[model samples]
Target: MFCSTELAARLEGVDTELIIAGSAAAAARRPGGDGFTIPIAGGVAAFAEEGSPLDKVAGLGFAGVPEPAELDAIEARYAERKTPVQVELAHLADPALAELFTGRGYRLVNFENVLGRTLHDDPATVRPAGIEIRPSDDSEFDLWIDIAAEGFANPDTQGVASHEEFPRDILANAMRDITAAAGVQRFLALRDGETAGCASMRISRGVAQLTGATTRPAHRRHGIQSALLATRLGLAKAAGCDIAVITTQPGSKSQQNAQRSGFDLLYTRAILVKD
Candidate 1:
């Protein structure tokens, strides 16, 4: 007798916890900074570093409208750290929270479409000619990071500016640390035996979240991403994951590729920032 909305909320909460945990682990490895999570009124606030990547308050949800005092305290905490207060609000999140933030000057900065699909039978996909996808090894770690950084730097992608400023060494270190954490896997896509793209999966609570899927500009329109997506789906299923989820910018080629590969839109999440 569980409602679909309730189920979605529960799943989202689990996913958010995994994200916060992984971020905290990665932040712990930072040379001069640390990552931590703070419990707020609705959900947890995850901080990676003062000005580092993905330093934001995310997975925000509330059973009911939160009091203004609670919101104020959250903002004050981030302000004290000299970083912008950011929140990610899923479609199912309390609408009142959005109103409260907007009234307090939080700008709607970005949007991400959450897509998911059940992993049953292995999805059929043809590996593009001269392309191969395989689990990454230590030797290919640096190459994977380089390809990911370049793919995310494309101006056509969301938050390209943030990705552009990411230092390669910092990113490489973070990736190495996070991927080493439990239930995380990285895959490399090679075209003619040369690295062309990368994808990552983090499994938790019977769900696999596919993230960091990127293909170099020169490798686009060649089905590299689609092949990787299919490969990961099969891997997730083989790893005992019941469902797979992915997030991407709305109307982007990434979304189109995911939908074509069997993922359906679940909901859209909005990113609000107070800077």
Candidate 2:
């Protein structure tokens, strides 16, 4: 129900689907460009890759996530050929689905945490503690990637790599390209000329997605994130955007910042991992 149009655009360009398996719109793989509605039962018994053109059944359906047997069937469909597989659906309705794949020999790897808050176009932008906010240029890509890896606490130093393996360079390139195309605006918070923290905002169809809110060790509790968030929301207001969404952990500084910046909770979407 909450799909980003920018995501739809990127998926169209890359010929990929996000695999949203759910009860309301189950067994329907909404095509990238135009969409279609799927009328099926069993609450998304499976989510498979698009094989042909989707039907124009309201164009708002979901991908039928495959079971272990279904995945095996699909894998066997290609045999020796390898394919990238990703699933980003609800963990409640089909909680055991990922495990089924792992039991069938599919390696479970990598994860991402998501948070969101509705956009307020009239919030005040306050840059407390002398924190500076500036628009970043193309040269900041590698730095952004580096900071991201650091923020994520990744030790590999593997720059911009996807969750999957194979052609590391190619995946990194794809990651950069996708992130670049998200129309994300980056702002770096500086403390006496050093990078204190950074935040990225992606605006699409009157919805603003806030991500990559990170602060350096020495810059914690200095109101750096507060300034950055206020500034970004102010920019969104000036640009006529209506909603801002951000995701953060419970009791985290990022959560506090969002609340302090006048962001109210809309909903929470969780990512369930296999132990």
Candidate 3:
């Protein structure tokens, strides 16, 4: 599919809404959690909590460029809570957005790529022998979080350097809140009857978002991720999603895997931060 401003708007809009929903879930699940969203320029700034992974600005510059005063107010909002402003600006967004951020002392921190593929029929998949993928049961929520946090804590070293890293406890917390969000479905990959990997998908407005997936360090290279991806894609297709999307650190292993599965690079987001 052609990458255009209109396409970017659609993709980013879904992501922004997901963030809002997840933040709201976090607030309801955690003690003293803050679920707040502010409109800045054409984007939405989200704050789930101090140091929460869900905190960031998305879908910026889709409406129109913001004045310096509006940017100042956005910055002030984050500053009030001792949090830095982290904006994920799509490359296809208005060029003036980046210029405004630079002029306002925002520093370019990292880049993440968004890849997508249209979904129609069930995706063809190769399931490694002895591996099984299934929806996680409600009773296994803690187990799911533990596996996800463990995988994240021991991330693969082959990828591009990560833009941001968090402690295992923080990762666990984030996973819990994300799972609490409406429309999110969690899946577990088992190898020889042992849990080896975990993944999640969220469908909104006919867009299936592969929110995240991780394999236990010991389970890496066992095709667990591929199985998880295939299962999610099939589920998304069956759920009537028109398209599916995923975000990954630029040049990272996740990006490599998605490409191997026939997803196309739709856009890259520059993570600009102001502290």
Candidate 4:
């Protein structure tokens, strides 16, 4: 029998592991800082390019309650790397993990809301007219990366923009690494033959995670993002995924669009950082 809790746990585990794997892959293509993984209390911490914008320990989760010894070990690992310890904690994670981080001087830095919806046979039926979504090709890779970078650079979006100029080389390298190793499916959204946005889907453990959904600033409010979401969901369904998930900042335009597209709020995850 498939229990809801069991399913949630499974999804959470795979989601974190996938992030770790993707980060390590991207770090390998960089010049310095070899990405590595450390066994933590109940999960794993993946360290990527130290000091780079992409650098962080991902998938920091602990099973049940964590002891002080476990917290010490985790901190020691990050200290050895000379990088601040950062953890993105899922809402469904053990409550003790948050308490331990708070007790250890870790501050909450980001809050991300996870949304999900069951995949239907014709998930793209809701796609807006005049917008076309298709699998991205090698020739379109640069454009896709550029669009994504621009979208993320918007002040309205979360996260600090490292540089005003697009980090083209880094973005290209990371995209190549992730595409080769993460089983990611990239899609480009076009409005009447012009590139409007980009989205990606990574399927694992019978679930499809929608990520990197972004629209060019000039293309906002035209339903491009919602159309991309529908297209990705359709693709995931066709690929045999039972459910599709996405994450966004709470109460943001992205979250509003997601809710309008029939996705329900699953939980909100927090990013904890120790400097």
Q: How do the residues 1-275 of candidate 1 rate in per-residue lDDT, one tens digit apiece?
A: 12255656766776666656667777667646646676665477776665555566666665566677877776777777788887778877777777888898989877877888887777786688999999987787878888888887663553312312566766775677567654568898889877888999888788888866888898888889899999988878988988888887788788888889888888877888897
Candidate 4 to native Cα RMSD, angstroms: 3.6
Best candidate, TM-score: 3
Which scores better on TM-score, 3 or 4? 3
Candidate 2 local lDDT, 1-275, one digit each (tens): 24363433322212122112121132222234222222221221122223211111111112344444544544443332233333333232234554654565544343323334444437775867667877666688667555544554532232222243223333234334334444557777787777767777766566566745767766667787787788887787777776666755544556666777766543322322221
Question: lDDT of all predictions, in order shown?
Answer: 0.75, 0.47, 0.85, 0.73
* Each candidate: RMSD: 3.1, 10.0, 1.6, 3.6
TM-score of each: 0.88, 0.57, 0.94, 0.86
The list of candidate 4 runs beyond 4 A from truth reads 1-4, 30-32, 51-54, 57-62, 155-169
Q: Model 3 over residues 1-275: C-alpha lDDT tens digits?
A: 56789988988988887777778877777667446777765668888877788889888888899877877777787888899989999999999888888988899988889999988766878799999999997799888888888887787776666677776666666666666775778999999999999999999889999999999998889899989999999989988998999998877889889989879999999999988
The numbered model that scores best in lDDT is 3
- Candidate 1 collision pairs: none
**Predicted structure 1, TM vs. truth:** 0.88
- Return the lDDT, model 1, position 19: 57
**Candidate 1: where are CA atoms >4 Å away?**
1-3, 30-34, 62-65, 155-165
Question: Which residue runs does candidate 3 get wrong by more than 4 Å?
Answer: 30-35
lDDT of 2 at 101: 48
